[model samples]
Target chain A: MINAVGREIPDEILRMTGKEPFQGNSYKEGVPFRRYAPIIRPVMDNTHNKMVKDIHEALVKCKAHNGMTVSFHHHFREGDLVVCMVMEEIHKMGLKNITLAATSLGKAHDALVPMIEDGTITSIQASGVRGKIGEAISHGKLKNLAIMRSHGGRVRSLVTGETKVDIAFIGAPTADEYGNLRGVGGKSNCGVLSYSHVDGDCAEYVVAITDTLVPFPNFPAHISMTKVDCVCVVDAIGIPEKIATGAAKPTTDQRKLMMAEYCTQVVVNTPYFKDGFSYQTGVGGASIASTISLTKIMEERGIKMGFGVGGMTKPMCDLLDRGLCRVLLDTQAFDLDAVTNILNPKHHRITAGSYANPFNKGAFVNKLDYVILASLEVDVHFNCNVVVGSDGIITGAQGGHPDTAQGAKCTIVICPLLQGRIPAICSEVTTVTTPGESVDIVVTDYGVAVNPNRPDLLKALEEADCVPLKTIEQLRDEAYAITGVPNPVEFGDRIVGIIEARDGTIMDVVREIKD
Target chain B: MEILKPAVAGTLESSDCMVTVEPGQGKVNLDLDSSVMRQFGPQIKKVIAETLARLDVTDVNIRVVDKGALDCTIKARVEAAVYRSNDIRKDIPWGGAIK
Candidate 1:
């Protein structure tokens, strides 16, 4: 079956996931919102001590059993230990057919691979899947089709109760005995637990796992005690060092610098580059460098940005501190600098639902004027692949790529034309994680390609004397000429993972990689 | 082409690699240390060899401490190191070497 973006979804996959193919943007305009009403229970006492000895006791209190959905947050990134620890106890109790709905999964969760293979963990729903867990999923270890959702999509689905979470295990850096949790003021300080807020609201049972237990009231709590039902004290929730290990820095490489400059050129040339513009850029060498260049350009023009949003980085925070940007709406802090900045009142911490949930009346992304994103590969049609790698393996995540791209007035994708022998600009992307319609421009070291759908952007670039513009096909040809045509990835018939658009429609599917 | 002295290029960072080249015995002795050696060792080596071949240089000791750099980056660093060793900064054959 051909999706709205014209990607072919196998018939077997359609039957397995039973989801509608993506029918382009606004296709969900008339779609009905799933109504949900959870059973409300009032706290009878002010004991301020909901502490449990271990995860087992917490699970017992939550009425843990087989065939239940459990959720975790990936704010800790690769250093997270809560997911594995919770799954280990569940496995030890002989609980099978468990659904692990996490915001994302990284190498830290590799310990769950054996659980997946042994059928201890039966389902997975996440924005990111990598390392051993990704390999297991790619080989079709899970009984059900692996569901992938962007940060916004995950929030929307959870809030609407389309996917009921039985238990949401939140890893808080600091929490009081009463269950008031703060991301900071603890041994392991992660910036914000924004992603878990919806889980806390939707889950039947909410557990707060913490390493450092503060006093009676953890002031300035990210998750209030009212939302948390139980608290589990662990020796450690995550490795602080590894949690923010790959905080991206501006690249010194000339090729990346060139692309970053070009990205800035697009922004500076755009009609929306006036005062009070909003911006967002992801964490990567090129993307980080682009942020730096963008700020410099803004400073030179003496035009202040209204606000910066999305995953906060050091460069973005610097702009906020320098008064180049009025405010920073941070959902997840990508580094220590960002984490520290979130403490300041000027940098407001926001929830995941308010950040990008399309169903919401207002999202920060909707106010964005410019958003720069990274891509593993981009096709001539402007569709991007940030999920699967060249070897047909799941190595990346959707995160907020699609959400910000759709929300921003000008969405620029900056990447090198080639990665190794693989062409970053290709005939067609390996998987369409972000639809082409949302993409406005593709900036490479070779040249910049504006999406044909975005004629205004093309006209703006053309009007700029310094901007070098090229056709998307020309960029793809240039990449092929240098790297040569790549061999098509061989995929097995079994569908392993299903990519969900921000609207909860099927965007693409990743099949099993052939050994 | 013969290297005049030891030269180095690139930096040891994630998704980047540092390459050091020195004059060696008649045979090219390559020393590689990479985080992604298990998956991309062979490919990295092949890139190094191709880059050297493009520069028309051989019989050198090349050391690479790779941090998961792509082939283009590896090639660019290799070409830069070779050019630095030869002290040939002016009139670099950019198109030929990069291709």
Candidate 2:
């Protein structure tokens, strides 16, 4: 079946996953379903001890078995040790057919490639995968198809009982003996545990792994003891330096600055640029430059942002610090500056469910006025691809790109016309991670294009006449003129992965790349 | 043009390609590995083949590790590798065989 974005979701895949094709962004509007509840082992006796000696003991206690789904979070990013540590134990235990469910996976978890090959892990589910694991999956090494969900979609799956995680291992920066975990006051401080909040609440068994074992109460916990079933102390959960790197300085690249200027013009000229507007942006060089450019305009016009959200970066945190923004709802901290800024009262931590889950009553993304995102590619249809690269490899994550784009009033995607000799604007993206209907504007180094679906925004930008505007088709043509139209990537018949929309519908399928 | 010894041109930088050439067995042989190979592999090979044909280098072994280089850059690198293989450094063709 052809999805709303014009991508074909094979009938075999639809029948296998029992999922509907993405009809449109609002197909799930006003839909209702009962919340899926996990089997709870209530602790009423006072004699039970929650502290475990090591990961091995925790696995045994959690009944780690073959084909069970284990969950993890990516709060530690590249510095993460928990996923490898736990999986190594699981592999040593001779477990087979285990499903690894993570919020996200990166280069740090490349060690799992051997496990994926050896049948220790047969299935994988996550927001996305990168590094060798992605290559391994793309090469059809895994026994089962990988399910790729957006940040919001992950929560929706867990909530709707589509995915049942048997064990959730949370790598907490600090934890008490009774399993009260906190994100700060530890050696490896990664500002917020926002992504794991849903894991803690939805998993059948939740284990808290920590390097810093704080005093009994670890009060002001990010993951309360109520949801935690056990606690384990490790030597190191993550490397602090790698958990959150240095701040992202504004870009000095002229093309990026020009795109940033054009992005600022679009934001300011749009109807959602007034005071009390909410905003989100990625940590790309162009994205940071856009924030800087938008900051100057906001400062000049005395327009204070209502709230800034997403993976918190230094620039966005600086806006909160300077009182240019009223609040900073951080889901993850991208830098050490953002980690430290969480001490501010107004800098709040939010759960992944409240951050972008479409099934929730209201998510912060729903209130967003503007979101500046970076894309690997944008097609003539304005659909953005953040996961797959031109080489037909899954090299990036969807993060909150789809959610924010669909939620925000004005979703602006900033990308250069060409990445090296490969055109970033094409007739069709290698994969559609964000449908064109959600994206309102495409700001390239060459020019900006507004989605024809959003004529109001198009008219508003034209009326202001402050920025160069073109149709998305024109942008794709100009890109092709510089880099000749590329041949489509060859693929095998085996479907390796499925890209799910935030509403739990199949948006696109990733086939095995021909070697 | 004739193959003399092994030679290389260009760097493995973004928007650049490294071309290596050596003596072959009476036929043109090309091996290509590119970052953008899935999309531009055939196009890059066509440019390299055209460049080699223009220079009349029939018996040579060529290898290209492309970092998303353009067609023009691919041609220039291929020509540079061919010229360097024959140790030709003086009065080289600029817009003639090189283009």
Candidate 3:
């Protein structure tokens, strides 16, 4: 089931090891590629005319063709200019069938449609896409599947050679001529250079594009210049304002606030209730709403949270900033503010393996005091699904839903009983991201349901008159009453893609049903 | 809406009678300067830990100082403390209980 660059992995590493190793044994000796030396130089002297001449020469050598994979990172998030600018050059070069292998797509790449239509690029595989480009991809304008990978998965893919990049276009937030980069010192400052680190190690040619060219040795460097090839200085790398606010704001809907209240109540009544206890909440409207309310309850009752987990966001960033939570064990920064705050030392940006890979020797998830996540549907059996709805269409992305759910002390799912015309509770979930075993509570605006296994919570909440605890069946029925349960989706069996656990075993297969 | 605020393990504040939670061991000797909160601190932390300890706990480290905070306030703070410190939260041999 696992292969890297036409060579099958030894069974000892694949089968004997219980945890599928997501990261390459960057430490262990493995097959190394033969070097194909190309003309490379860091533009320490941008004022010197030789630097521009080198870039023009390098561009001439990397002449493109159909299906040629190109990669970039969103260190600048919405502020990026290199991808579009490089695409303009590719368009000028009249290249077609190019697939953009980005670590993560950003709103800044919205300019790709003209290139997409003109056949300069063909496909994508990264965390998620947004803005006009996302709309374009969602409409199935591209010929191939829009492969979505989590932050860690992208790094894993690039390193393992599952996806090879012909040329990695790295736009530094701050870098010196010798190519050492740091986001904190530069003007843009979006912390966490984990994405580009992998690309630089694997890609054939890595081009460094920068606006702020520091000294030869940049301070607090994330990516060393040794991996970088050609250096190109631009007028500006990105626009700061647009990249900072894209996914920062939380929803303030009254119903969302109502739902958040019930969620906070679950945390309030749980056994983990104590000073310095830790937990994680989703970036969704309902989960963030609960976090803010939980923050208020903590403030009111003179409590402080220990650590926050999973996908980090702005409000959670607020909790981190206020000293409400001591540390943010962040795997992925879900919004602009998180990216910005991660720039500040107040928040920490962690690699995927450190944050959620269950196979790791000591992952932070295993030490979580509590974990609260959002869900698409829950069933009477208590199984939860985040990837698909009743229609079985892929509505959700498997962000960190399963990994943290597996490790937290008190896992709660905070969601509305119903959404749109679909019931949030159903006979069975369309997909299972988190098995119900780890989940301890399900909170809705109307009531809360403690897992049968957690009867003490049930008993105490009963005494405390915490939100009424009902059977999962009752929650589903309530949702059904509001919006009748939809029929199950019919599907075809040509597996479009497979969802594998970090250990690389195929957990589930997503088949492509006729559109 | 009579929202239920939970109290986890923490310290006592004497002046405003507020319980404070500082990051560290799951339990702390609750100390307070204000005369009003003199009765709290260690008393609440001890009571809350023994109460929740009936449920499975892999680890806990907490520090708290309290002043005349109500039972509700104490419980809310205690819950927050427990939820943040330890994460070994699966198939708790048993989970729901109260002092």
Candidate 4:
């Protein structure tokens, strides 16, 4: 079946997953459903000690078994060590057919490839997969299909019980003996534990693994003791330096600066660029440069941002420091500056479910007026691909691209026309991760293209006459003229991954890359 | 034009290709390794062949390591390597032989 973005979702996949193809962005809007609650074993006595000896004991206490779904969070990113520690313990216990449901996975988890081959992990679910594990999955090493959801969609799946996690292993920076966890005040502080909140709430059993065991009542817990079932102390949860890096420096690349300038013009020219506008942007060089460029304009016009949200970075935090923004609602801190800046009274932490989940009462993204995003590729249809590279490898994540794009009133994607010899603006993307209906504008060094669905925005840009405007087809042709047309990436018949829409519908399928 | 000695041109940069040319066994021999080999390998080879054909060099061994260079960059590098193989530096036709 063809999805709304024109990608063909195989009927077999639809029947197997028991989900509908993406009809449109608002297909599930106003739809009603009941939230799934996990079976809990309440702590009725004060003598119960949730502390466990080690990971093995934690698994035993949680009842390690075959064919069980376990969950993890990616707050530690590339520096994470808990995934490997927990999975190795599970493999040692002779567990088989286990499904690994993580919020995201990176190169740090490549050690699990051996287990994937040995059949300890037969299925996988995450926001994205990278490194050797992605290559393993692309080569059909896993026994079952992998499901890739956005950060928002992952929360929706957990909330609706579509993916019921039997056990959740949360790597906390700090945890008390009673299982109260905090993101700060630990050796390997990552600033926030937003993504694991849902897992703690919905999982049948929750384990808090921490390197630092603080004193009791780790006050203002990010994950409360009431939801935690066990506490396991480890030597280290993550490498502190790798968990959060230094501040991102502004870009000196001329092409990126040009696109950044164009993005600023687009933002300022649009009607949504008013006082107290809500904005979100990634931490890419171009995005940071765009934020810097926009900051100048905001300062000049004396306009203050109502709030800045998403993966917080130095540039956005600088906005708060300069009083250019009123508040910073951070889900994940991308740098050391952001991590240290969270101590500010105005910089508040939020859960991932409240940040982007479509099924929630309302997500922060829905209140966004402008969102500047980066893409691996953007088709003429304005559909963006962030998960798959031009080589048909799952090298990136759909972190909040789909959720924020659908929620923001004006969605602007900033990208260079060409990435090396490959054209970033093409006839079609490798996959559709963000549907075109949600995208309003695409800013490239060559020119800016407005989605035809957003003619009002086109009119606004034209009337303002601030930036060079061209049809998306023109930008694509200019790119092809320079780089030549690209041949289609070869793929095998077996499906390797499924991209889920934020509303719990199938958006696209990733086939095994042909060897 | 004829190959006099081995010569090289271009650098291994993001949007550039390194081309090496030397005397061959009486026939054109081209070897290519590109980051975009899966997508634009044939087109890159076609550009090299066409550029060599225009230069009238029929028997030479050329090796190209491409980091996603455009057609123009490929042509310019291939032409420069062909000219440098014969030590022809001065009085070089900027547009005639190159274009």
Task: Name the best candidate (by DockQ).
Answer: 4
In angstroms, the error of model 2 at A264 is 1.4
Displacement of residue B6 (Cα, Å) in model 3 is 57
**Candidate 2 global lDDT:** 0.92
Provide the clash count, candidate 2.
Answer: 0
Native A-B interface contacts kept, per candidate: 0.00, 0.89, 0.00, 0.82
- Model 4: per-residue lDDT, tens digit, A1-515? 99888989999999999999999988888899999889999898999999999999999999889999999998898889999999999999999999999999989999999999999999999998989898898888989989889999999999999999999999999999999999899988889999999998899999999999999999899999999999999999999878875357888999999999999999999999989999999988889999999999999999999999989999999999999999999999899899889999999999999999999899999999999999999999999999888988888889999999999999999989999999999999998989988899999999999999888999999999989999999999999998889999999999988999999899999999887
Writing each residue's lDDT as its tens digit, candidate 3 over B1-99 gives 011222344444331234333443443334433222222334455545663454333233333444444445555555545543444246422234443
Arrange candidates by TM-score, descending. 4, 2, 1, 3
lDDT at residue B71 of model 4 (Cα atoms): 93
The 10-residue segment with the lowest total lDDT in model 4 chain A: A240-249
Quality class of the docking in candidate 4, CAPRI style: high
Q: Which candidate is the best by lDDT?
A: 4
Q: Give each prediction's DockQ, rounded to 2 decimals.
A: 0.08, 0.79, 0.01, 0.83
Score residue A424 of candidate 1 by CA lDDT.
Answer: 90
lDDT of each: 0.87, 0.92, 0.62, 0.93
Tell me the tens digit of each residue's lDDT in model 2 across A400-500: 99999999999999999999988999999999999988999999988899889899999999999988888888988898887789999999999999999
Comparing 2 and 3 on TM-score, the stronger one: 2
The clash tally of candidate 4 reads 0
Candidate 1 lDDT, tens digit per residue, A369-469? 99999999999989999989876789888999989988898999997887755689999898899999999999998999999988887887887866678
Clash counts for all predictions: 1, 0, 58, 0
